[model samples]
Target: MSSTRSDVSVLIPFSKRNKDQEEALRQCPSVQMSDLIFSDIEEKETLLDYVQRVKKLVTEENINIILPTCDLSTMVHAAIARDFPHIPGPTVESCYLAFHKAYSRQYLDPAADLVPYAVVDLDSPTMLQDAERALEKVGFPAFVKPAAAQSTFGVAKVKNYQDMNRALQNLRTMRDEHPGFKSSPSAPFFKDYFKQYLDVEKYPLALRDVVIVEPYMDAEALYTVDGCVVDNEIVRWAITDEHRFDHGDAKFGQDLIAPTSNVRRLTEAALGCL
Candidate 1:
């Protein structure tokens, strides 16, 4: 039987100022209003520390469940769930694979995939050779981005070598500024990466060790699933279409609909595969 009095913790990675977040919190009957707003800056250790603190709080405050309410929070929660069997949610490795564009595509498991992609090490000179091959494979009008990034922050749509060079230069600068970009566990292996493709002195590459090159997807429509899981089984769920502003930031759509038949089938398959 469910406990009469319950304590729940909801972690939102970005910020509480987001309107969709505010609305989501407003609607949650189980979550306390005060237990909100956890932020993660560029610091990696902060995340490790935050999870440890949350684990302690769960015991002291009796946090029955931890809800990952945003893109970043999902990662944080997933990691915590790995070590603490009591912390219920997606595992860190699962969330990491899904969040990464390069890895996410692998899970799609399509014979002739909608998106064409390649993974590279932006720090290696051989990356140019690798990129040339990838370009030939994906063709022109490709999208280049950090392997593990969110939104359209470092994303570039390039049509030629000249455009690709300029875009790569800009991405290298962003990489220097964001440490998490370079420090991923998978960064060291890519033979051709940021080094071959960028000017490190000017860009001052920070550490985005891996990069993903892909054909630009014609994403006219996008959707997301917000769900809760107990024992790796999804329970409560809300499916929402992603509506973007001029800046391309996504939130709860004004028009809400259940997942598309295709998306539902695909998501179920993906989950089962997980």
Candidate 2:
């Protein structure tokens, strides 16, 4: 491989969303970005085609990095980077476990120290029974979200079983109408992959439609720890304090203040997420 430009060039697997990131990148002469009409990963065929398309672009443009612009692109970027050998990205297996909340809980440490949660497969024959058990685990005043989602889109705060029923019903019949569900890079792309590529008995969440139910964590404050892993070492940066607006129930982050503190707990939490 020949290196031409000293400046960095990146390929975002998804199309340009005219986001603030694009504007910010334009201000930096040291950075260049490439995007196309690409959208969500609906299936395995689309995932493979996207991988090949990125491979060609990376070679032709001499792109130095393949960046994932959204949650859906994590695994896709991993697939593209596999061929380059030099491009550094998370492995597909790691990304797979990370992106799906239930999967993360199942395969990772399970965050037993955190709130106990439940996973209910929407398509399961025992869904109602599972939900009943989930309610028992989480009880009233619960938070619900998709098994895999983009940001806070499909998330909802439920004070009762009625709310859970409505949320689950929307997830079943009105998925397209759900903002969080639509915002996601679309489709439960892992469904078929689990059948063909992995052990279904071990990772059965992929076998059916699933959602997460957990106790609502009420806090007077929230913080996000920013950091990066370099050469397999994790370094702490700054922690951002957040305040969420009450959406009839507390939901959205209305205000953010960064560099709020240099706390060791922040670093520990950030590493846990990674």
Candidate 3:
């Protein structure tokens, strides 16, 4: 969890979240990492049980103001914020929408001009039919991944049926290496909280460990808007505009200051350092 310590941003890395990816992540020039305790829900442990378990540590260690830093931690952030109302964070429904691509596509609907896509359950009896329908709607050279993923850990670009199978194999392999992903059996609390807002009978695929098949977005430039919220006000920070791979790695990733469109500078904002 990322927090603010006396106005200096501090990040506490949890072992369960990073696990096998820890070393690869530390190689990034910008990350500030520390050796922290591992956090996870044991078998038969309820969400409240897990939350209370972590809460004890939080209070004992004087942890305050935990904000999520990525897609995987959004639900965890919501749970923590729910326990401590004084600590601000996104709501369970909002976090669910952001964390799951299939639901996000459903929620966005006709409002957004998104490409056609399908949500396929890999373990479902109708898995083949689902994939067929997905590819039919979305078309070739599609991008695929587990409905929920952190970073691009399980994502792949596929051009045909064989490629899709290969992508799922890679995804399953990653899940084995890195546990706690929503793609697998999620924590009880994470699923329980979602039940409040979603109708399981109507959208069974919403919370299931499914795969989302959609057309690959090959953009010349990809951008990310990073910011913080305080008292309902959004404090816009740096806007990172990154180019595609150079030697299999991002060629040029630069941050533009303050706002969208009318970016006046080339350097990163203070938050970028965090």
lDDT scores in order: 0.54, 0.62, 0.57
Number of the predicted model whose TM-score against the real structure is largest:
2
**Pick by lDDT: which candidate is best?**
2
The sequence of per-residue lDDT tens digits that candidate 2 reaches over residues 1-274 is 1222334566666655555545544443333333322344333354445566667777877765665645667666777666678677766667778777887777756545777789887767887778878999988889888877655655778887778878787777654443234343234444544444346787666556679898888887777665545457866656667645667775755465776544333322222322
Q: How do all the candidates rank in terms of lDDT, highest first?
A: 2, 3, 1
Rate residue 66 of model 3 by lDDT: 53
> Against the true structure, candidate 2 has what lDDT?
0.62
lDDT of 1 by residue, 124-153 (tens): 788777777778888887877777655445
Query: What is candidate 3's lDDT per residue for 23-99, written digit by digit as tens?
Result: 44333344343433446556555444556577776666555445344454556667777777755567766777766
**Model 2 misplaced stretches (Cα beyond 4 Å):** 1-8, 15-49, 110-112, 176-202, 236-240, 253-274
Residue 263 lDDT in candidate 2: 39
Better of 2 and 3 by lDDT: 2
